[model samples]
Target: MRFRRLRAIALKELLQIWRDPRSLMIALLMPFTQMFLLGYGVTLDLKHIPVCTFDREASQNSQSLLKHFEASSYFAIARNVRTYPELISAIDRSDCKIAIVVPPDFSERLNDTGTSSVQAILDATDDNTANIAYGYAVAIVSGYSNDVALDALGRQGGELQQIQPVAVQSRVWFNEDLDSRNFIIPGLVAVIMALVGAQLTSLTISREWERGTMELLVSTPVTPSEVMVGKLAPYLALGWIDASFCLIIATLWFGVPFRGTLFTLFATTTLFLTVVLGIGYLLSVLIRSQIGASQVALLLTMLPTTLLSGYVFPIDQMPTIIQDITYLVYSRYYVTIIKAIFLKGAGIAALAVPILFLLVYAAAVMTLAARAFRKRLD
Candidate 1:
């Protein structure tokens, strides 16, 4: 309640942070290191997938189909196989993820029955990659079939409209280019905020105990509320700084889109930081060992954020039980809010539900953390 005492305690803690080299390294270097590492290292986009082919006919039609795969940005033709064993060996050696086989009667079937099939073999070890590659192959083959159909129709002197199917007009919004980085950077920002805020603040009260200063702190006239606020204020500011750094790197360096207002970003981020900082401070007050507190804080913040928060995986695709459990992880709400704000240009009104959840979470955590800290050494 006393501003003077709170200011003095805050200054003392800030001075302690300045003096501790490990704290300085954590507070300064961790953000930069995490941003670059996760931003570039983690991704879902697959490009230039290796492909091997076996053309049974060695005919012009088969060669043309092979050219279609080569021209695609998603596939690179690595080998032209003479036999089925060669195709299998290429996949076994991991030289190619996909294999294409042009049938011997491919052109004859097309001409006689107006239909033909090309065999596609896939290495299904990584099923997700295999599925994506299969879809790409299907699209390329479908286009080639359509081209052949049109050419046959022209040769027969028939109008294109007679064989034409309905065309689909698709549109993409938010992340128009379908760049994963656009959404990923925002999720990274949320993770960094939770991680750095908790990890840094976890050491605050625990450090006081380890340095033999708990006695002095107990003897002071400062109320528990004042001590808690003073100890956490510096970290709250630091959370914002870390947030700013992440935003700058994401928008400028990595070129992630920023579609929302600054007010929406700051408001949600502050609520998120309060929740994480409270969790860390509570850990610090309960656990006297600085190392123990820090480790527990890291486990609490990082695991749920990365795993259950729909960061790298889709929550809908997870098991029903896991999807229900994700509701309890605080980072899930923040991740959803952040992605919406970054990609959809959402505002406070649009994000009322998640922001409300965050506000309640912050209040509950602060209540527990503020009451957890007492001047008594016991």
Candidate 2:
């Protein structure tokens, strides 16, 4: 009998949600759109860095070295300069990110002393890109040097077996291709859900107050607990649908791997939705103004979820106080769970701490929201 009442309230809420086209659009389409924008728009991979060369040698060996740089997909030779000043000008003008300076005695010294040196100058304004480009340049030069050394030893009647070195083989686990999208798309699940879940419920009760319908509902036979459950039900279903869309897009469109079972994914998403929805409900009950509730919800959910939740940045690298404050951000646990499931194939046993934290967070926020609702009624 009591279940029938809850069902009626839930149905009414669903009807109301349907009546508002904007709300319906938000619930049905916003998450997928947001994920698409963020997933494809942002990237960290560096490629095709422009390079300038100052080749004083004009020799066969110097030209050979330049050919190696030109052959690599990582670098594009933008200009060949005659002077050091011209090389500096190319980098300063943003025409190139890397500059290679080959000395005049390059081939002569290499043939005579079995050694040669070249200088690589890099633009350090963007440190991460600079570092990666430097590494690529170093690797290319090192490989060329090794080949030259091997050829020189062969001409000296040395055997290939006496080249003298260890060959190392490396195997990357989990994400072998090392695609940044693999790491990024999974964390986006938590971020998108945090925004969608909170934004949906943030306006619910507050909109009732704005439209003068709350007093009517309060005067009816429907209990505050029933109203709360009804308000949460439709949005919870929407949240699950949004989460499923995110998972599908992450896997099919973005090519992110999902190594965990659907059961674990659904369970973690439910716990996360509960916490975010409770926060929105509590805000709605306390603020009673739809505009204020929406603003507060945006502030609470979106910024922290993207920034502090380790979705884009590592929380461990943050200062001690900031790291401590991140414990309060519920999306942190969800991001951890989502990434682990998508990347590591972590089970419930491996993710017990985050799961426990989400449980506690859901319980605490929902209890607070219930208390706030009752107080508002009084």
Per-residue lDDT of candidate 1, residues 239-274 (tens digit): 888888888888889988899998999889999999
Q: What is the lDDT of residue 85 in candidate 1?
A: 90
Off-target runs (Cα >4 Å) in candidate 2 are 162-169, 375-378
Give all TM-scores, in the order shown.
Answer: 0.96, 0.93
RMSD vs true structure, all candidates: 1.4, 2.1
Supply candidate 2's per-residue lDDT for 102.
96
What digit string (tens of lDDT, one per residue) describes model 2 on residues 1-378?
267778988898899899999888888888778888999886666768899989999988899899999999889999999998898889989999999999999988897898889999999999989999999999999989988988877877756666567978899888888777888889998988888888879989999989988877777677677778888999999999998999899999988999998889999899999999999988999899988998999999999999999987889999999999999999999999999999889988999999999999999998888877752356
Q: Which stretches of candidate 1 lie over 4 Å from their true place?
A: 162-164
Model 1 scores a C-alpha lDDT of 0.90
Best candidate per TM-score, number?
Answer: 1
